[model samples]
Structure formats: C-alpha cells, structure tokens
Target: MILAIDAGNSRVKWGWHDGADWASIATVPLIEFAASSDHINPFSITHGDPERIVIANVAGEGAHQLLVNWTSIFDAEPLWLHGEAERCGVRSRYDRPEQLGPDRWAALVAARAVHTGPCLVVNAGTATTIDMLSGDGVFLGGAISPGIDLMRFVLHEHTGRLPLQEGSYRDAPRNTLDAIETGCRHAQAGAVERMHRAMGGNPLCIVSGGAARSLLELLRLPSRYIENLVLDGLARIALSERAVTR
Candidate 1:
C-alpha cells in the first residue's frame, strides 16, 4: 500500500492506494488542519499502515510538520518529494531544477503518465502555474501568475473600496464585483490559452488544482481534469521506487 499527499497553499489532499486502486481519498482545508493534524489524525485512522508514503508539499513549514506528525505513529517515514533533474521519464528544463515547486514537478510527472504527447499542465489554485512538457517527457518550463482568487484577493487587499469577497464570473459583468471576477477569470483562462498556443501544436491540457473546474469551461484547448494530479504523481513515484527496490 502507498499513501500520497499533496499539501498545497490553501488545502491538503491525500489518498491511499493498494496496488490496484485507491483504498481512500480525502481533502481538508488548511483552516481545519491545525486541529486535524495536531489532535485528530490527518491520513487514515482506520488503514493499518502504509508501506510507503509520498508527499508533495508547497504550503510551508506548518504543512511539512503535519506530515511529520502523522507519520510519527507509523513505522515508515514519509518521503518528502522535491523537484529533481529527472524522474519517472520526465526531465525538467528549469534553470535551477530544484527551485521549481514540488507541486508543479509532481503535476509534470503525472502529465507524463496521463498524456503521452506534449502537454500544458495547468494548476490553478492560490497561485496558478502553467507548465509545458514536450512529447518525449522533457518538462519545458512554464509560467506562474495570480489565480482568480489571488487576483481578487490582491484587489481587496491592496486597494481601498473593493470588497474582500469574490463575485460571480460574467461575460459582461453588470456590476463592480462581477467585473472584478470576470476579469480575473479572463486572465486565468488567457494564461492557459497562451501556453497552449505557445506549445504550437494541439497539446493536451491536463488541468488540476482548486480552480480547475472554473477554468475548464473557459479554455479553448482540449482539456481534462484530474482532481489532484500532485497526488497521482506521488503515487507514480512510490510505485516506481517499489519496483526498483524489489
């Protein structure tokens, strides 16, 4: 059995897979994590113990410790995943490969598994990251920009007058709130579209992260959504290591 965890900026997603299929999968907002990690169990209270646990953490130290705290009760220590030069057929193009976010790297690995051809990997969450991958599994680096929520948040935080809450996305917004939201969506969608165009051929756009659904309808390129690809890549990495060791 293998456990995979993706600790993103705003939430934490986890799943446990037993070779053939996932035994369990769940997500918890970071707001609830302090209590969940410290008091209640974050992974699984029922599953005996995971043979291997792989994690991709981009939230920060607190999240790093949460995994640490969970693995304390088990015999196996969690393998904290970081971006590398190459792994599982995907090679990175980042100038400083390790500097690339782990979440992004995991998504690239997942892209390699899901899309055999070139792909534009888009993860729209606290921050939206769009990365390009060549057909042969070379991770041609991409871009990062403010997500829909982050765009709204910055407007609310930096400026005066704008409300802190987000409004609905509109084609032609009637009011201020909707206008802000609509503009934000356009930017998010535009980034994906631009990346797809840059890839120059019709490439599969494998989308994930919290805002994936919102961006799905707006994107012009062929797209598919995987709930949390970071988790999928974690599972891939774990299985690869198991095969090597065996």
Candidate 2:
C-alpha cells in the first residue's frame, strides 16, 4: 500500500492505494491536528503499514512538525514532494518552478494525465489558486488569492469594525453576514471566471479543495469538482517515482 498525503493550510487529506486503486481515503482537520495524537493511527490501524509514504505539505512550520510526528509514529520517512522544473509529463512555466506550491504542481500533473485539452485548475482551500495548463501539458500558471474564509477573516481581523460573519452566497445580499459571505464568494467565483475567459473562454475547469462546492454554483462557466486532486496528484507522483527507481 502507498500512503499519499496532501497537507494543506487548513487540512491534511490522505489516500491509501494498493498499487491499483484507492483502498481508502480520509482527511484530518488541521485545527485539531496539533492536539490530537490518535488521528494519524486510523490508516495504519485499518489498512496496516504503507510501503511508501508521500507528502505534499505547504502548512508551514507548526504543521510540518505534525507530519514529522506522524512519520515517526510509523517508523517511516515521508518522501516530501516539491514542484520541479518538469516531471510526470507536466512542464512548469513559472520563472522558478520550485517556487510553485507543491499542491498546485501535483494537481497540474494529475490534470494533464486526465485532461487532453486546455484546463484551468482551481484549488480553493486555505487559498484559492487558479492555475492554467495547456492542452499539451505546459503549466501556464494562473492566479492566487485569498480564500473565502481568509477573505472574511482578513476583513474582520484587519479592519476595526467588521465581525467574523457567516452566511451564504448571494448576488445581492441584505445582512452584514450575508454581504461579507457573498462578497467573498463573488471574489472567488470572479477570479475563476476571469481565468476561464483568459484560457480562451472554455477550458476544462477542474475545481478542488474544501470550499469548491460553495463556489461551484456561482461560477459562470461549468466546472467539475474532484475533491482530492492534490491527493490524486501525489499518488501519481509516488507511482512515477517508483517506476523510475525500478
């Protein structure tokens, strides 16, 4: 079995593949990750030990320690994944490829494997990333902006009066909470729509991340939501690595 982990800013998603298909998949909320010792045991307890552990982590120092602890628990050293200049049929267009977030890079790699045409990959997790991939597998790059929650939080924390509000998406909202929520959603959707147009107006848009569903209905263009693009990418990278070694 192979353990594929995508540790983002807000959550840690994982998948177990028995060299064929996913045996199991799950996620751990990062809020409780620092405090919970038992959360990492489920995969091992239920599926036994993984032959290889791969991770694409962008959670910073505090969360990095949590992943380290997880590996220690299993006596396994994780194969930390990075965005390189080129790998797994995807070429980076970034000035410095390594600077691209591993999550975005992995998603692009996976997207190329499945998408044969132009595609815009939107990963709306802690941050909303809009990356464009050409039909032939060139990472043309996209946009990165504040996610819905972070947008609300920034307004509340940075400004003196705005409160942390909760509501739903609306084009014209009445309440303060709803207005804040709508604006955030609008910002996210707007960015996505803009990218879609920039990508010749009809690229295959693949949306992923926790807040994907919230923005799905608002997007002007149609999109397909696959909840685990990062994990899927990580799994593919793991497979490619093994093949190269053998």
Best by TM-score: 1
For each candidate, the alpha-carbon lDDT, in order, equals 0.88, 0.84
Distance from true position, residue 189, model 2, in Å?
A: 0.7
Best by lDDT: 1
Find the 10 residues in a row with the least total lDDT in model 2: 37-46
lDDT per residue as tens, model 1, 1-246 = 898888888888888888877888998887687556356886657678889988888888887787788777888878888889999999988999989998898899988998899989999899999999999999988999988888998999899899877789887899999999889899999988988888898999999988999999888789999986888888999998899989
**Candidate 2 on 49-149: residue-level lDDT in tens?**
77778889898887777777766666556888887989888989999898888899999988887787889998998899999999888999789999999
Residue 237 lDDT in model 1? 90
The residue-level lDDT of candidate 1 at 47 comes to 79
lDDT of 1: 0.88
> Which pairs clash in the backbone of model 1?
none
Give the TM-score of each candidate. Answer: 0.96, 0.93
The C-alpha stretches of model 2 lying farther than 4 A from their native spots are 38-43, 73-77
